[model samples]
Target: MKALLTKLAFPILNALEKSEGSYEYSPSHRTILKVMGFLFMVISAVGLYFSMKIEQWAGLFPVILFAGIGILCWIVAFLGSDKAVSKLWRNRNE
Candidate 1:
């Protein structure tokens, strides 16, 4: 069982580590992460709307799950690199 679980988890762990490593404070990488985060937020919004419309309380679980993921993505995109945040602030001031 442990071996099976390890096999299942290894790829996910590897992907996450690889993605974390890709955050190199580059403008392009920041833009991509921000865009992905926004997309996740949009998906979460849609999920929320459908959940409310259908009045399925059970459906809220998935909505909340997506919202959490969206929030996480946004947090990572914003907080992953101090340099990216500083660059954004500098651009805004100009």
Candidate 2:
């Protein structure tokens, strides 16, 4: 049982390592990112829905906190977006 489990796990580990080495974004990965982005948008919408439902939009803290989370998620998405790493950093001339 132990040997079979190890055999199954080894391929997953190797694939993870190979994925980490890739520079160009794969199509499937892009699709996944799109799905994640949609999910986050929905999450923000839900937060707004709750704020409105509770009728606490007039409060300063609630307005700031929920909207602030949505804004933060957008900022993080922009900063951490997938892109090809530039080769200029490497000493290619050497």
Candidate 3:
């Protein structure tokens, strides 16, 4: 299942995974990333619910935004390596 997901998200993972650089790693970073992803997903769900309830197409903007961010966060947090997480955090070695 993880392999299949990694394949599915190849486009997003490619650049980050391929970057050449040293990075600082922390277990907490990944933990916080997962937490933020879950929160963004929750926000997206609420946005979707409100959009449907209010019957307003404009609300979909935030829904899509949050959902996209949430999905990205989830992909990186779960599928990416420690290096990828560090890259996302912009913690490349100086």
Candidate 4:
């Protein structure tokens, strides 16, 4: 029971821990995440505009696209970015 609780809570804790921004993850990785996030927002905005200007179905497409990209960014951000950055720094400083 404790193990199960820990397993579930660990992911949550990791999420909260990762969010602190105090750790200063690798700049390149952070940049990539930021760019992807920005692109996702921009694409979504474009999609929304097109959708509004066109058909309801078309407008919804941007919403889906943005959500998908946002999800992709979250996944990439969680799995990577900071680690890659720190590794690069370690190499350069050494």
Residues 1-94 of candidate 1 have per-residue lDDT tens digits of 6556546555433434333212234566556667877887788788888888988778778777877766655554555344443343233222
Q: Write the per-residue lDDT of candidate 3 for residues 1-94, one digit (tens) a residue.
A: 9999999999998878777858898989899999999999999999999999999999999999999999999999999999989889988895
Question: Residue 85 CA error for candidate 4 (Å)?
Answer: 8.6
Candidate 3 residue runs with Cα over 4 Å from true position: none
Residue-level lDDT of model 4, residues 7-29, one tens digit each, is 65455335433442234455566
Work out the TM-score per prediction: 0.55, 0.39, 0.95, 0.46
lDDT of 1: 0.57
Model 3 residue 43 CA deviation (Å) reads 0.5
Q: Is candidate 1 or candidate 2 better by lDDT?
A: 1
Two-way TM-score contest, 3 vs 4, winner: 3
**Per-residue error at 56 for model 3, in Å?**
0.7
lDDT, candidate 2, 40-90, per-residue tens? 566656766776888767554554565555443333233333431111111
Residue clash pairs of candidate 3:
none
Better candidate by TM-score, 1 or 4:
1
> What residue pairs clash in candidate 4, if any at all?
26-85, 51-59
